[model samples]
Target: MTNMDTLWLAPALVCYALSAVIFIAGRLTRTSRASGWAIYLLGAGVIFHALDLTARGFQAGNIPVGNFAQALSFFAWLTALASLLLIVRLQMAVIGAYSVGVVAATLGASAIMMKGGRIVLPASLQSVWLPIHVTLAILGFSMFVLASSVSLVYLAYESQLKAKRPLGPASERPPSLEKLDRINYSLLGWGFALLSLAIITGAIWADATWGHFWSWEPVESWSLTIWILYAALLEARLTVGWRGRRAAALTIVVFLVLVGSFVGVSLIDPGKHGGWFG
Candidate 1:
């Protein structure tokens, strides 16, 4: 990458690092102030990430959605942005640690992958559906990640309560169990909707470029698997009255599937989407 093209990485990494530190501090001290700082840092990181994506797009003379580094960077920014919005709307600063941790992991992986190779976009990827498909997918994935984080916290809190253990101030920082459940479902609803849109747009793009809507590419298969799992989770919640520990467990499982599709499948197969890892 050119110096100008890569300049955004410096600030992005710095902000992520700062956000991580603040998150850890907040977790350790059980203070909301540190979490607030983390939220601010995450916002700064998102801005830098946007600049980086914009620079790469200009350099490529098209949207930079074909490569792993760009996709991961975009995903990280979307997650951070979603987390920031949640914090602002729900006043739940306690989840900052988990959100920042996710961002750090994604960006760190992208940086390593970038050092290994350069991304080369294909002509087929240049289309109107590229942005639509990518944006929806990233947003859906971000919501799933957030839901997973909250589910984790819920399990931990529930365990502490069951064991009659003192969770200190940290336990008090998150919302109530009912509230957490509501938030998880809300995120699931939005995530599922976006994911459906992503799938449809991807199919349309496939048809436009390859004369077929479904080809069973490795990435496509994994994405469909994830979608099916989430769909099942939503159905269970609605039809079987799934909630509390059961719902949380199901969400955790679905989120694992989502991560597998996002990272593990890419690493293991690296099929047509291999250009993304470059």
Candidate 2:
């Protein structure tokens, strides 16, 4: 990366970290004001992050997902963007207490991984569909991240309620269970739509690049598997009227599988996307 890239990325990372700290503080003390301010800080971080990616894209003559570090960085940025959207739309800034920590940790890992040096986008992935497919997939995954985070909060909040325990004094209260469930359901619906589109575009890109729609490669197979799981979850919720604790628990479990499939499978399997991280 260039010096200009570092200049943009450094402040973005700092803002993300500071936002995480503030989010945590607000949640612990039940300070809505602190959570509210963290949103602006996170927004500033996203702007700086976008500038950094733009700089790298210009330098490399392509979007900056050519390397693992760049991919992780991009994923982190989108996750933060999704978090902002969820919090604002729901008017529940406390979600950031969990969500922003994930963003900060992801961005920090991306920064650490940046030492691998620059990589150019491969010719095979240079199609116009690259950004469309990648963005949709990452955005969908980001939504899952938010859903899973909210699920955790829901489970914890429900547990306290069930136990009839005092929740951090009278003035300090978490979001209602109904609100958390609503957020989870909304995220799942939107994420499923995006993931479905991503898979379709990916198949088109595959057919264009490799003369086949489905290679049954590890990456392709895992992507389909994750999509099926998400689809089933959503379907069950819609048909069986699944909600609250059961749905929240399953959402967390599904996301773990997703992370393993996307990150672990790509690193271990000697398939089309195995070398992506290297």
Top-scoring candidate (TM-score): 2
The TM-scores, one per candidate, come to 0.91, 0.93
lDDT by residue (104-211, candidate 2, tens digit) is 999998898885445677777777887898899888989999999899889988998899985665565667899899989999888889999999998998899899
| lDDT, each prediction | 0.80, 0.85
Candidate 1: Cα lDDT at 52: 84
Residue-by-residue lDDT tens digits, candidate 1, 1-278: 56865688779978987897788687677666567668788889989988987877776666676577778878888898888888778976767778778888888877766642234467777778888888999889999988887787778767877899756666465678788888888988899999999989989888888899998988888888888888888899999999877888899998887776667777788776676755
- Quality of model 2 by C-alpha lDDT: 0.85
lDDT accuracy of residue 4 in candidate 1:
63
